[model samples]
Target: MTTQEKRNLIKGLIFISPWIAGFLGFMLYPVVASFYYSLCEYNTLKPALFIGLWNYIDLLTDDIFWKSLWNTVYFALFALPLGQVVAIALAVLLNQRCVGRPIFRAIYFLPSLVPLVALAVIWLWIFNGEYGVLNHFLGWLRLKGPNWLGSTTWSKPALIIASLWTVGGAMIIYLASLQDVPRDLYESAELDGASGWHKFLYITLPLISPIIYFNVIIGVITTLQIFAVPYVMTGGGPARSTLFYTMYLYNNAFSFLRMGYASAMAWIMFVIILGATVIITRVSKSRVYYAGE
Candidate 1:
């Protein structure tokens, strides 16, 4: 290369050097180290002793690990679809030309901006068995409310309900996608005697299908790693019904000093998230619609 070209390349590299260094130190190193630790018996107090798949083998027999996995999956199954539907519905309502539209949108989205721990604390009071706002309201209607955070049967459902409170973030994304749908398509469909349901099913849905797919992929990843709220509220109580995967992983790493085991769990979760994302992408290949061919 010419001297001028070499100088230009060096200048360009200098401009991006910080990003390259950060990626190597903060991202790449941790990932590579985690994999190595996963294969060893490591605690923070002692050196990592190479164990060659023993941690992974132990996980196969760990009953609590299996329980945590099941709890996470159950929560995801209900939380993901319900959150998507509610967010999309809210987006659609907000998209309409109505008075106080901005006010309503702001109200709906404010909850997502609240800190996760603070949100959990607020919900803890709301879900209390007696004298709680929810149960008090149910009392007036002669309907009894269960101990939400205490009952194994209802704990997961309670978390699912709380999960909906943060749907505002997804709703904002859906609203953006909804606004981009061409107005002429809806007008043309109306001219063809298409009803509201028909227009939504045949036109609106097809146009926003890509956004829906994007939300689904994100929902899968986040729901699988859910931890904070359950940790704060129930502490995985009432027979470990709320012992999610990440919470259990945290306990192993910190509480039990099983860093190697926790690392293995983390890698397993990584694989599961990757597989789920791939499956969703494959499924959406034929369903998701882009604006242009």
Candidate 2:
């Protein structure tokens, strides 16, 4: 409407232009292309040929698709809850006033900074049935350690365990949330002779419920897309027990040259994650507390 307003608007657009360009080139284009590709049969060597809903139809009858879905579901179910508990516990500990607090925080958080591939490689050795550190420790305790990665029954569980090493990132978020909880509430509770557990259960948990909701949504999304660690560590495993959805998608796209099929799977995963997040947000609506609420 005015020269100054127009200049300010232009300057604002200029400042965010990199992000806009990136969103178009990297995110938006891929999303659009993936949707189109999902409707076709593609091999990178040749152009995609449209095939309508055949990919979705085939996936419905596909055993591996179901198996991968189930495996992914199992991983997400266990990983999210366990990781949340561990992160919150760690956060609570770190929230305490103590000696070497910064050092302890750094030590706990360092694992999350390790590359997933590197972490997987390290855990691969750690979970070795024989002559590995974990087994050796079990042996010292006169306990037998099963073949973790080699066993179909245990492989997914092992991956879940390994991935928990990165719960430090979640811990940091929880710790920050913990700090924002009103100190006066705790002091008031103390005046009433409230025990530590009582204070935490009634006050701290309520205040940090929003963070829990945020982290749960994030965990659900992240765990659903779990690929790197299992891909590197178990190669989807001894009996395909760890054949995650993404791993199968990768196989279809690269291993089998079924790019269109992979695209379909990606879209399905997107829908599932989106639905789950929405459901979680809706379910958490009443429980998640903010200062004003």
Best candidate, TM-score-wise?
Answer: 1
Off by over 4 Å in 1: none
What is candidate 1's lDDT per residue for 1-293, written digit by digit as tens?
Answer: 99999999999999999999999999999999999999999997999999999999999999999999999999999999999999999999999999999999999999999999999999999999876788888888999999888788999999999999999999999999999998999999889999998988999899999999999999999999999999999999889999999999999999999999999999999999999999999988999999888
Question: Using lDDT as the measure, which candidate wins?
Answer: 1
**In candidate 2, residue 124 scores what lDDT?**
93
Model 1 pairs in collision:
none
Query: What lDDT does model 1 reach?
Result: 0.95
Per-residue lDDT, model 2, residue 282, is 91
Note the residue pairs that clash in candidate 2.
none
Instruction: Name the runs in model 2 displaced over 4 angstroms.
Output: 2-18
| RMSD to truth, every model | 1.1, 1.7
Question: lDDT for every model?
Answer: 0.95, 0.94
